[model samples]
Target: MEKIDNIKNEINYYLNKEENVKEEWIEENHPIDIAEALSELDASEINDFTKLLETEDLADIFEESEKDLQIDILKCKSSEEIIEIFSHMAADDITDILGLLPIQKRKELLRHMKQDDALVVKNLLGYDRESAGGIMTTEYLLLSKNLTTTEALNKIKKIAPDTEIIDTIFVADSNKKLVGSVDLRDILSSDDEKKLEELMDDNIIKVSADVDQEIVAQQVAKYDLTVIPVINKSGILIGIITVDDIIDVIEAENTEDLYKMHGVDEEESSDTTLLQSIKSRMPWMFINLATAFLATFTVAMFEDVIAQVAALAAAMPIVAGMGGNAGTQTLSIVIRGIALGEIDFKDNWTLLFKEAMVGVINGAATGLVTGLILYLMYGNYYLGLIIFLAMILNLLVAGMFGFLIPLFLQSLGIDPALASAIFLTTVTDVFGFFVFLGLARGFIVYLI
Candidate 1:
């Protein structure tokens, strides 16, 4: 953190100096660091800092900035400047920035871009922002399968400056259909007369353009690939998704799932305004309150029993709280497994059984300790027995509901992570209270 602060200070210092020094300093630092520093600056400072760098340098920093900051930085530039910056940016990055802008502004900017570049960006913009096609770049090496090693190498050199990745170059047939891929090393080592088709790996791992980003991420991780090709429905090569973009996709998806699991909107962040935060959070807060009331109603049903056995009130929270904790533990694991594609509907029965057994074992262990503690505290044998049995029952409820709720949500075409914990807590709380209190009601004479 201190190092970033130092870098930010240094950038600010250079921005105020002569243009030559500022250009040199910007060139010396990483684009990510410059972007981080720009984020720390005020509006006027960011405007001034942007003016100091050339379009190419600015484009690098622009590509590294967050979507909001990217828009802010663009707001400081003229139409001509923005177009020039767009020219230097990768197509995928340009599409991302444009996607965040209003439709009119996005169309105007695309109008000014070079006709071919605008067409590419427009095509990219047509896909869902969370799909493989949306995160892929058109700027990748594509050599004809008929090209000899020497010809391919020469072609690569000519286009490498505009390409996003050259480590693996894709091959296409005369009909422009993707056929195979060849490593840069393979091309370098092959005989100059050898054909690309002979040297290329015919077996390829690729995804359709419309495939979800999560599935793309899983495939990339499973195959240990640094880059994956994207294809259209006709099996024609369209774009390539590099590892860097995949990393960002993975992070964004994980953050989204985590936020949804906790009943928070993924769009809300610490930097959001008070009103924005309230808007995002109020609905979830109200939903939780409703669930809380349901638990209260369950307790209200057993009010007479609770009144007679005062010890029930004291021991009630322990049952519900422990059950909630246990449910959350199971929910977290199941959600993670689902996200990673480890759990499918075919395995639901086996998975549920395994989790139920876990609940039983954990319940037994925790119930023994809880029973011993209650027995020591009150010197009532039945109180200990009631709590022990209640713990086991409540935890069993926790495990079963936790495992089933997510799968049920998923089968209904809903995101399993969305409010899953909220549902699990409601189930655990209501069931835990009912079981613990009902047991107390049965043994009230002894407990008293």
Candidate 2:
């Protein structure tokens, strides 16, 4: 942390001076450090820092930056400067930054970029931001499958500096279709006259442009690939998605699921203004409010029973609260498993059965403790029995809802995390109250 502060201080000293900084203004600093310092600086400071930094360095920092800051930095650059910095960046980074720009500004900036680069960026922008094309880079080497081992090595040596990842080189057929791939080590070790086709591994694993980013991450993980090639519908190689980009997709998806689980907007940033924060959160709160009242109405149905036997009222909260906790415990596990692709609609039955058994076992244990306490307090065996049965029943309900809510929402093409907790809480609370009170009412004569 202290070293990071020093890096920021060094960069700030140069930015504070209004003149052109001959001294490196974070151009030589690590991209992570530059990103951290830029995050802390104002628009003017960012503008100053961008002006003095090299385009290559700025590209590095831009690639490492958050979405809002990327736009801010892009706006800080002139058309020519934007082209220079953007051309230096990976195509995917260009798409991300351009996605955040105003329509007019984005168009103008793209117009100013080199024609081929602009075309790549424009085509990439058409893809969904969470798709394979949106995160893959066009800056990659596509070697001819006919080239000899030495020829391939020579080509790699020349193009290595321009491409993102060179650990594996893609081999293309006459139609520019991705035919096979070869590791750099194979090229380096093979006889000079060996044909590239003889060495290339033909069973190439690749994905179409429209595949979800999560699926892309899964492929990368499954194959343990540092880079995966992106092919178009016609089997033509378009670009490649690196594991670094895959890591970002994984992190962002996890964060989105986490935010949704808590009823928060996935796009909400920590730096969002108070008004913006309020706007995003108020709807969720209102929904929760409605659910709370629904639970209130359920409780209100037993008002007469509660008034007659006040002990049941105090004990009722315990049953309902415990059910809520149990439901939430199952909810967290199911939601997490779904996000990781471990649980799905196909596994719903097995998952439901497992959770139900888990619920029964957990319920029996927790119910026994509650029953004993109730028996000691009221000295009424019937009341204790009523509470114990209610506790077990409510827990089973909690477990069922926990597995079903997310699975049902997913089948309906909705994000389960967004509404699973809300519906689960309502069911557990209302049902927990209903069963506990209903049983007490049935045995009301014995309790008094």
Candidate 3:
């Protein structure tokens, strides 16, 4: 921490200089570090310090900044300055920043950019924010299938500067339809006279523009690819999604899954206002309250039995709480499996049987320990036996529902993470209390 503070201090000292010392400092340090240090500056300092950076340097730093800092930096610049920065940024990056602004501000800024660049950004923005085209860059090396290895290499040299990635070169037919891809290494090793059509690998992996970003990320992982090309309906090459973009998609998807699982809004953050936090959480809280009433009603049905056996009332929460814990453990694993495409709605007997057996085994173990402790506490064999049976049954219920509910919800096209916990908790709590209290009522003579 102290080291970071020192770096920030050094950067701040350089920023205050009147000469062009800031340029040399920027050139010497990483853009990410510079952006981090600059994030601490106030609005006036940011406005003045940013004006000293060249378009390319400013664009590099902007690309690495957090979304809030990126907005702040942009707000500090004029329309002409923003246009210059846009010229140096990748189309995907420019689209991301523009997407954050109000529609009127976005349009006004687009009007100031070059016509071709503006068109590219507009086309990108037209796709769903969570789709492949939304994350793909228009800059990629596209070689003609007819070009010889030597000609393709020469073209690559000229185009590589402006392209996002040159490791893999896409090939297209005469009509501009994507046909194949060739690694840069393959092109380098091939005979100069060999045509790209002969040298290129025809088994190309690609996605259509509208494919979901999570699916795109899965494909990339499955193929171990560094780049995947995007095609239009007619198979015309449109853009390429590089590995960096796929990584971002994976991270965002994981974060969304986690938030949904916890009943928290995905957009809720540390920066959220107090009112916004309450607004985001109120619906889930109300749903949980409704579910709580179901458990309370179940307990009320057994109130007479609990009152008769004071020990039963004391031990009531133990059974239900343990079942809730067990259910939660199963729920987390199942939801993760669904998210990673490892589990689906298919009737896999092996998965279901495995989970059931696990539930039964764990339930028996927990039931034994609980039964022993209760027997020692109350000095009554029947009281211990009642809790023993209840624990085993509740845990078995926990395991089965934990595995089944998410799949059922997914089959109905609902995100299982969002509502699975509520249903699972209600089932465990209600069933756990009913079984424990019912057994105590039946064995009243022995327990007393």
> Local distance difference test, per candidate?
0.88, 0.86, 0.89
Residue 416, model 3: lDDT of: 92
lDDT of 1 by residue, 154-222 (tens): 999999999998999999999899999999999999899999999999899999999999999999999
lDDT of candidate 3 over 149-245, digit per residue (tens): 9999899999999999988999999999999998999899999999999988999999999999988998998899989999999999999999999
TM-score per candidate, in order? Answer: 0.97, 0.93, 0.95
- Ranking the candidates on lDDT from highest down gives 3, 1, 2
lDDT of 3: 0.89
- Tell me the lDDT of candidate 1: 0.88
- Per-residue error for 198 in candidate 1, Å, reads 1.8
Please say which candidate is ahead in TM-score: 1 or 3.
Answer: 1
Candidates, ranked, TM-score: 1, 3, 2
Task: Point out the higher-scoring one by TM-score: 2 or 3.
Answer: 3
TM-score of 1: 0.97
Segments of candidate 3 deviating more than 4 angstroms: 18-24
Candidate 2 CA-lDDT value: 0.86
Candidate with top TM-score is 1
Q: How close is candidate 2 to the true structure, as a TM-score?
A: 0.93
